[model samples]
Target: MIRQRITATTDPAAVHPGLAEHQSDMIRRCPYLGPSVDRGLTVWSAYDAEPGDQPGLFALLVETAEELRTARRESGPLACRNIAILDPEDSESARKIMQWPAWLARNLYAPVQLMVGRFWTGVELDDSKGRAMMPPPVSFFSLRNAIPSKDGLFLSEKLPEIMAILEQGPGDDGRDVFAEPLGRRVDDPASVYRELKGLFPPPSLATAG
Candidate 1:
């Protein structure tokens, strides 16, 4: 799952200047303006989860935005600036990037499938319609394409090492590691795979002639 955080200026003037102009351009290009525009900066983030669990991400985004809005109302308008918390390749840098985005979209928007391949390599969709719908020249991550490690700790290529870090027992850190609770005990990869199969069933076999 890739997480994104977006921040933008509270001042109306500082909001994306070209956005209003683009609105007119879009109207000219397509007469259908499906929704009313509310002027605010919005941040977003996403995670990989079963389709059933997407509501939680949306809820989190909404709650964060409401909290920030309430804080600004009570204290005063915030300083004009935008910051995004992105995954840093290193531990120390990652910690520094943990701050929340101010305004967030209520909708839990997934990456426009065009961008999904950039992070998720070897991803195969079960549906033919889905494969056909994908944007052309799909980009993906590879060891050769990865950004160089600043800390000289090249764990990115080490899946076992990464998994170990992920599976570290609780009380080590409060950070939510698993998106959903696991039913099977740790070290049980087969059980995990079985559970996943239940959640994400294989495409049915084609009928024999």
Candidate 2:
């Protein structure tokens, strides 16, 4: 199974020097996320209009080229409509937000404000030369909505409410927050994001005519 590696940075030049001049080579050298092998490069970068400040960026290295193609096919017209142009600043933001428990804590309270992101994907070579040096192409989608956001409450105020809610039982309000059957709740990494952040419901699959 392939997974994406997300990172955040305040400075891209420091992290990956000469990024502007050597986009492809430099990007390929970015640290490998883990045991999972990434197939294609899909990147998104979001920027703020305020000067002297950096834009938040995110990069998504998907599982396989074939898998990415399948994703586009499933996307239908969405693939054409949703694309973005990525820059260094945007890369840094993505790296920062992925910093583990701290990110969870911060986002649980006040959600960070963000604009729609520009999307990108790698373009595999079409010739017999193979995919030695592929170019990244820009595309757009409303993927920003899929990203989790802050819930607009101070940490101090939110913790107690969350704790209290966790303690409640079906007897309290006739609603079972823990109603899933034991077997049904077994470890599902696929739903982990939904479990953790509770945002960005899965895309709606199109129905056959």
Predicted candidate 1 versus true structure: per-residue lDDT over 1-209, tens digit per residue:
33433333332223333333433432343222212122232222222222222233323333443344444344333201122222333333322222111001200111100000122212232221122222111111101111112212322332223223323323212222123434333342322333433443323211110
TM-score of each: 0.20, 0.19
**With candidate 1 superimposed using the best TM-score fit, by how many Å does residue 14's alpha carbon deviate from the native?**
11
Residue 176 lDDT in candidate 2: 19
RMSD of 2: 18.3
C-alpha lDDT score of every prediction, in listed order:
0.25, 0.26
Please give the distance, in angstroms, between residue 7's alpha carbon in candidate 2 and its true position after superposition. Answer: 20
Best candidate (score: lDDT):
2
Point out where model 2 deviates above 4 Å: 1-19, 26-45, 48-71, 74-95, 100-209
Write the residue-wise lDDT of candidate 2 on 1-78 in tens digits. Answer: 212222332222322343333344523542321111133223323222212111111122111112333444554212
User: On a 0 to 100 scale, what is the lDDT of residue 201 in model 2?
Assistant: 23
RMSD (CA, Å), each prediction: 18.4, 18.3
